[model samples]
Target: MSSDEEWSSGEDDSQPSKLVRKAREAPFVPIGLAGCLTLVAYGLYKIKDRGNQKLSVHLIHMRVAAQGFVVGAITIGVLYSMYTDYVNPTSSKPKK
Candidate 1:
């Protein structure tokens, strides 16, 4: 094969390609942080509000807050998954 073709095909140039792959695989930090913060705030608010209510009302709020937290967590998971699978296409697999 021609030298130019060999070089362009990248068989001997693995390091840069590996670096590029690593960069692409990097996790998005900001969105993940936001999601975590949102979940924490929701939990705290639920706790604080629970102390100010009748038992029935408090239970209702707690239920709603639990749902919110779950949704937020799932949203973050889905977004990270999407970023890895489609947007970045090189990110590491999510930890089990």
Candidate 2:
């Protein structure tokens, strides 16, 4: 008779978690998030070094920079999706 440990070991434990699978499937999302975070951090650093500019102006520019980066990332993700779907789909249906 197989021991409990042996039976359990036979089970497939190598499958990745849902989060890991999703991350692998849509890697751009995490990349975009990281880029947004980096931009925000840089903005904060610049704000600390603000010499003569008003706080409001610095804040506005920072906001624009962060938002612009996120927008660009989203656009790239969309374009990539479109290309994969239309130009080179991974799974195509068989013809009748």
Candidate 3:
């Protein structure tokens, strides 16, 4: 037997190649925050006012608070998506 044949750790070359995978989705924060936000909005909606004059004011206040929370959560989701999927510089520096 040849020394060349004896030295080889052989592997077959007949398999088809596969493409690299697309990036994975971010796990849970966006959805969890969304749920909590919904619950808060519902709670706000269910608050009762004794007078009709104050009910409109209460609903409006609740609506504004819910809308603000939604906007803030959406902003956070956008920034997180951008950081995970688009902002790969291969390294990060820790804050002091």
Candidate 4:
């Protein structure tokens, strides 16, 4: 009998076992990159609105808005990273 036929004919439990094994092995690089990108974008947006400021009050308002945007972006990034890493680690990495 052919090797493929022999392997497929067996009523083994290795399929589920292999899936379980793979579920335990994954990387977190993408999660980290996503977080860093979010922070960088926030920083850029926060700093890019400081042009042609005619009054101190306007400048202060801009600064406060910028800070809020940055903080919100960072918080979202961190929460997403943690969720992806802990709640669904298997989908975080691709199979090689």
- Top candidate on TM-score is 2
Q: How high a TM-score does candidate 1 get?
A: 0.42
TM-scores for every predicted model: 0.42, 0.67, 0.43, 0.42
Computed on alpha carbons, the lDDT of every model, listed in order, comes to 0.61, 0.77, 0.56, 0.58
lDDT of 1 by residue, 35-64 (tens): 556655765666655655676776566557
Please give the ranking of all candidate structures by lDDT, highest first, separated by commas.
2, 1, 4, 3
State the RMSD for candidate 4. 14.3
Residues 26-82, candidate 4, lDDT per residue (tens digit)? 223334444556655664565657577545756566556555555666577667778
Flag clash pairs in model 1: 25-91
**Per-residue lDDT value at 34 in model 4:** 49
For model 3 the TM-score comes to: 0.43
Model 1 is weakest, by summed lDDT over 10 consecutive residues, at 23-32
Which candidate model has the greater lDDT, 2 or 4?
2
For residues 1-96, could you state the per-residue lDDT of candidate 2 as single tens digits?
746444445335455665576777777777777888898899888887899999999888888887888788878988888887898786433557
RMSD of each predicted structure: 12.3, 8.2, 14.2, 14.3
By the lDDT metric, which is better: model 2 or model 3? 2
Residue-level lDDT tens digits of model 3 in 33-94: 56557856685657753356476777676667666766666678678767756795343334
List the candidate 1 regions with Cα displacement exceeding 4 Å.
Answer: 1-52, 93-96
Candidate 3 lDDT at 85 equals 60
